[model samples]
Target: MSDAIEWVAVDWGTSNLRAWGMSVAGAPISSATSDKGMGKLERGQYPQALQDVVRELGVEDGRHLDVLVCGMAGARQGWIEAPYLEAPTDLRGLAQSSVRPDVPGSTLSVSILPGVCQKRGGENVMRGEETQLLGLASTQQGYEGLVCMPGTHSKWAYLRDTHIGQFSTAMTGEVFEVLRTHSVLRHSLTGENDGAARDAGFGTGASDGLARPQDLLGQLFRVRAASLLSGRDSSWCAGYLSGLLIGTEVAAHLDDIGEAAVPLIGSTSLCALYATVLSMAGKDGRPVDATSVAIAGLSAARQQLA
Candidate 1:
């Protein structure tokens, strides 16, 4: 299988590094992953980390392999800095702007795709998500719509005729984890979520958030207050907090989302959570596989480089 591989595709993020051995036709023939991501590695350690994953994909020693990387591996603190391509940028021709970093003592010919940045309306940037957006465009030719990629930092982007016109981001997941682990709210949200109660709590909290997003600061304390007053369990509290954060995010973007079926590009579970909230607002949330699109996006880049 290694002999059949034409090139390798990689999505090296902060916490994880994922790789795929691609065939000559662009389909992934083999795959591998590692916990040794940009956040964990020093500048000099990137080559070894990447080499380990590439070897796992069955690439032989001394064999020349063209590796296309997207994500934080190209950040300033990453292996080598791949500069940001400012938006209103076309997702196509990403390879044209990609940076080739020297990997001493390795047979890997690595190219890191540049991330996208928004400068006019706000100062915003993205790395791996830009590749996923490119993949979205590859799959849905001439695609134009609002895209939501949910994770630690949820990104909402507008694909205007295959060009990334503008985008906004929300730190929904990271904030939830911080509040749950570090804040006073942790005391009230420290247990496994019970299904029915969690659902009920989520619905109530989502309604409150959607109706009064401006009052988010005021609403947060209510979770703890409700627990102390009514003895609400951890399950309800956790669910409520999650729903509230997500709801507020959705509310902020509601004007852009008017009646359109949003393409939720992320993990299945996270997308489902967003889907539930979109449904509440009588809108559709179409789940698109992040991994598949990432590969597709990388493949699109590979074609250009080839």
Candidate 2:
């Protein structure tokens, strides 16, 4: 075994490609990222993009670096299709479903992990987030609770003894974007969702959604009406809209969350919002850094290859 470096882990999502070079001991040694993600590149361009980034990171020359990847790079539209593993799966089961893509003339040999799917009630799918969940499972031994990863489409997953039992996706973030940028609600939103506005508007909107989810449609329109009638500012309206959507999703899942606090995995702002909503509802939100968890997950998968 070469003592120089071990393997590389890559998280190739729709918008970005992030990679980490780690030692055999599982400590990260170097890192790189590129804007050329699965969404940005053609199927054939993946090798070059990956090779370029790895080279830029000063990887050992002439070595066939084993690269374990997770995220959309394995999507049907990605470099190679890694089929989805159904719910109630062992978190580490992702690697068993992983697929290796042949990359000619590259110093990297790549294996992309498969995503998880739920086809029960309404159809739902998650790609990159599965890796994070696996990461969560890797570190959170003996943890039995709900994991919420809030993003463009937030995911709520139940972890039973560290295995992923079932999960659901919420379009709360996407819906917030749509209404804020494209709808009449845009007029009431000033594109500013700062802490102050979040404090002022989020609580109110969240309370309304929690109490009366069926009134979401009416409440949505009220953002604009409040701005026009009550002289509400754009920041207030923007925060309110965000809060309302988050509240609706949270309320829907509150019953399932039981007595424990939810472990949240996502960006800081989004996690803060989730924490706020959960706190207001007499629950707690525990933040986990998404990057570290992703690396830990990839490390866990890498261990499987041995």
Candidate 3:
């Protein structure tokens, strides 16, 4: 049993759930994950699922432990609905909107945090990235700038001194997955995508996409043509496609990024890829660990409740 564990921090998303054993000083002593996520669990199974993950800590003897959770756990279809907090709001407001679910006889005291939403010119909602933004804000000490959290549905958020001003999302990853697996382009792909050849292809495609974004349609079709005509390797094609999508996403929002270095939070590989795009545009990209930020954000929210 972890005697030093003051509370538990969880990041429950669509594909997996990660739980951290945190000390009172905000340090993590142990961590574990479950493949069972919001996508797999029913509305009533959340408590048992989460309860099992942290059961080793021995909190079942009437000594209920505080559990701070972010992400899809707060989704409408998840454990309990913690309505989204609007943008241009302070990060502290996230904890304030947290809802405690009735877990019956569970040994955990859970508070699911509210995600952030943009309701103005566009309609978008994020259930997990908000905690990451809060985590980034906590570390940077009043962080103000644009943050890029790239994934299946990448997020670009603007922050003004720890407050979420506004944000946008891109379906680039989902589109890429669909086209690669279900489209005609699937036949053109062969070989494992990696190494120098892939990078070269990515560079060329990213530069082209950034230069002439309007011709993106024509360029996408060229991937198939290149494979048939020049017998281009599937790895290169994959890299090129990734570069094209990432470049296009970045180019369209170039004006909004300003001249300041944009912070890329989340996956190191994905953030590094975004950093490459930013570099080509004469801007710097600062990479921040997604896990660390999420954990810290949970700690901050927990502290607020304390």
Q: Which candidate has the top score in lDDT?
A: 1
Model 1: per-residue lDDT, tens digit, 201-305? 888888888989999889988789989999999889888998999898899988888566899998898899899999998789999999999999999988877
Stretches of model 1 off by over 4 angstroms after superposition = none
Error of 2 at 197 (Å): 3.8
- Indicate whether candidate 1 or candidate 2 has the larger lDDT: 1
| Residue range 46-155, candidate 3, lDDT tens digits | 98888888864444445668899999988888889999998878888888889999989877889999998879969989998988888888888766778998899999
> Cα RMSDs of all predictions?
1.0, 1.9, 1.5
Deviation in angstroms for 167 in model 1?
0.5
In candidate 2, position 216 carries an lDDT of 88
RMSD of 1: 1.0
In angstroms, how far off is 202's CA in candidate 3?
0.6
| Candidate 3 runs further than 4 Å off | 56-62, 192-194
TM-score of each: 0.98, 0.95, 0.96
Cα-lDDT of candidate 3: 0.85
- What ranking emerges by lDDT with the best candidate at the front? 1, 3, 2
Worst 10 residues of 1 by lDDT: 252-261
Q: Per-residue lDDT tens digits of candidate 2, residues 276-303?
A: 9999888988999999999999998888
lDDT of each: 0.91, 0.85, 0.85
For candidate 1, what is the TM-score?
Answer: 0.98
